[model samples]
Structure formats: structure tokens, C-alpha cells
Target: MVGGAILRKLEKRQAGGEDLTLVTRTSTELDLTDQTAVRSFMQSERPDQVILAAAKVGGIHANNSYPA
Candidate 1:
């Protein structure tokens, strides 16, 4: 919900000619917990800024499997 709101705001700004690019990826496409994957992605994209709104949402089993 928070990420969606931020994304909407960014989209509005972009539409209003903010001169910025929004880069996004789904969890399936990019795993935030993987250091190597993140490093490779950052090197390839070289984005000026980043909005880290990623979260891991799941129930008991998932929570047990992946503890933070």
C-alpha cells in the first residue's frame, strides 16, 4: 500500500515533467535479498536515485522459512 502510493506520486511528478526516470522490478524479477543479483542490477542500471519500497509479505510458514 505504501509503495503503491509512492509510485502514484512519482508517476504524477513524471507526468508533470519532472525529468526523471522510474525504474521498477517485481520480486520475481529481482530478489532484493540476493547481494550478487542486486550488485549486478545496480551496475547495469546505474540509476541516479532509488526508492526502496520493497517488502516481504507472507504468513507463518514463509515467516519461519525466512526470518529477518
Candidate 2:
């Protein structure tokens, strides 16, 4: 939830030609547990900074289980 809000703010900023490459993926699309897929994604994208927004703080235990 927090990450998504931040992403929206960044998107608005990028509209002013910040040239930021904001890469984001949901848990379903990019499983953090899979090392091979993560390596492939990082090599292909080569992000300068990685935002590790893997936690949902205000959530129930059942809804906040990270695959790690």
C-alpha cells in the first residue's frame, strides 16, 4: 500500500521529465524467492537503485507472508 502510493507520487514527478525508470512488480509477477528469475530480471533491467518494498505492514498475518 505504501509502495503503491509512493509509485503514484513518482509517476507524477516523472511527468515533468525526471527520466526515472521506475520498475515495479507484484509478488505474483515477480517471485522474490526464485533466484534465477531475479537474476535475469536484474541483468536485463540493471536498475541503479532497488526499492525493496516487500512488506505490507498494516496487514493481517495471513495476508503478509513473504515467500522468503
Candidate 3:
């Protein structure tokens, strides 16, 4: 939900002629837990900025069973 909101705001900025590029990927496309993959992606993209809005979501029961 939060990620969606941030993306929308960025999209609005881009539409308003902010002179920025927005690059995004789904969890299936890029797993944040893999250090090697992340490094490779960063090296290839070399983005001027990054926004990490990804997260692992769970319910109350799951949280209780496995706390992080």
C-alpha cells in the first residue's frame, strides 16, 4: 500500500516535468534478499537514486508464530 502511494507520487512528479526517471521491479523480478543479484542490478542500472518500498507482509497470527 505504502509502495503504491510512493510510486503514484513519483509518477505525478514525472508527469509534472520533474526531469526524472523511475525504474521499478516486482519482487518476483528482483529479490532484495539476494546480495549478488542486487549488486548486479545496481551495477547495470546505475540509477541516480533508489527507493526501497518492498516489504514482507503477514497477518497477526503469522507475526506471532514467526516474529522478525
Top of the candidates by TM-score:
3
Model 3 CA deviation exceeding 4 Å by range: 59-68
Return the number of clashes found in candidate 2: 0
Candidate 1 residue lDDT tens string, 14-64: 999999799998889999999999999999999998989877678789989
lDDT for model 1 comes to: 0.91
For candidate 2, write residues 21-55 as lDDT tens digits: 88988889999999999999999999999978687
Expressed as tens digits, the lDDT of each residue in 8-48 for candidate 3 is 99999999999988988898999899999999999999999
Candidate 2 clashing pairs, residues 3+ apart or interchain? none
What CA RMSD would you report for each candidate?
A: 3.8, 4.2, 1.9
In candidate 1, the residue pairs with backbone N, CA or C atoms under 3 Å apart (3 or more residues apart, or in different chains) clash, namely none
TM-score of 1: 0.78
- Using alpha carbons, what is the TM-score of model 2? 0.73
Off by over 4 Å in 2: 56-68
lDDT of each: 0.91, 0.84, 0.91
